[model samples]
Target: MSDQQENKVVISLDDLLAQAQLLKKQIDDLSAARAELLDSVASIEAAKASIQELKTQQEMLVSSDKKGYLMFKINNQPPQKVLVYLGLSYYVEVDMDTALKILDERENELKEASTGLDKKLAESKAAYDQIVDILNQIQAQAQQKGE
Candidate 1:
């Protein structure tokens, strides 16, 4: 055998396929995580906009599936406080400014998490591509040997 052929590192086809499967799973999981993070960010933005709107609006429409929609009149007075969710089913009542700040912080955290997941997803996809390339090369080599 030539030196070039002797220096080749042989990897099992089955093992490569298994690794590709695992990488595909990882990519899917990362994509789901990133999607959740983005959803959280959007929720935060909506909350921030509602808070800002409440400062200027005196009347609002509230709705529930069981009660339908109700128009509430605030006597031309803005709300003094609002409840902010702090994860794990915990909520705190605070002034509008404080609530906005908390939401901003939470949005930032979610954005950071999404960004991290994006990086991991990219890496997993690259690994999956490399595995597929290796499998294709193996298939081509087997065909050549058979010929």
Candidate 2:
């Protein structure tokens, strides 16, 4: 090839390499974000399960006198009042109705947040796929030029 043609090939390869590196970084960032979202979803689901258990216990308490092991074994205790978290290492004792209301509100908030995260994950995946397609095209072009 002429010097000019060779220069063009070298420049194109360099450009493609730079683009690949940037896309790889973006993919890594997106993967990390997705992982975080998954973790949050898992945590919220676990919290929801705990709230459901508490709600069940509250119902049982209202019906009749019964004792159950706290934290599965800390101590057998009667469910008289519920301790509700008030954020930042604070908790307030509240009646069953009030505590259930708070839990319901928290559940709704978590559901909304989960929905938003799902949308963000979908968008990130789409962007990642497009970048991958572009990278593949670049690789094919490079291979063709090399032949």
Best by lDDT: 1
Tens digits of per-residue lDDT for model 1 on 87-118?
A: 89999999999999999999988888888889
Candidate 1 local accuracy as lDDT? 0.86
lDDT to native, each model = 0.86, 0.62
Model 1 residue 60 distance off true place after TM-score fit, in angstroms: 3.0
**Which stretches of model 1 miss by more than 4 angstroms?**
1-8, 62-76
Our tally of clashes for model 2 stands at: 0
Give one digit per residue, the lDDT tens place, for model 2 in 1-147: 598776763436567567657656765775676576566556546545655666555332222222333323323343557787766899889776677677667656656766775676577567657756867888899899999
Worst 10 residues of 1 by lDDT: 64-73
Clashing pairs in 2: none
Cα-based TM-score, every candidate: 0.83, 0.57
* Most TM-score-accurate candidate: 1
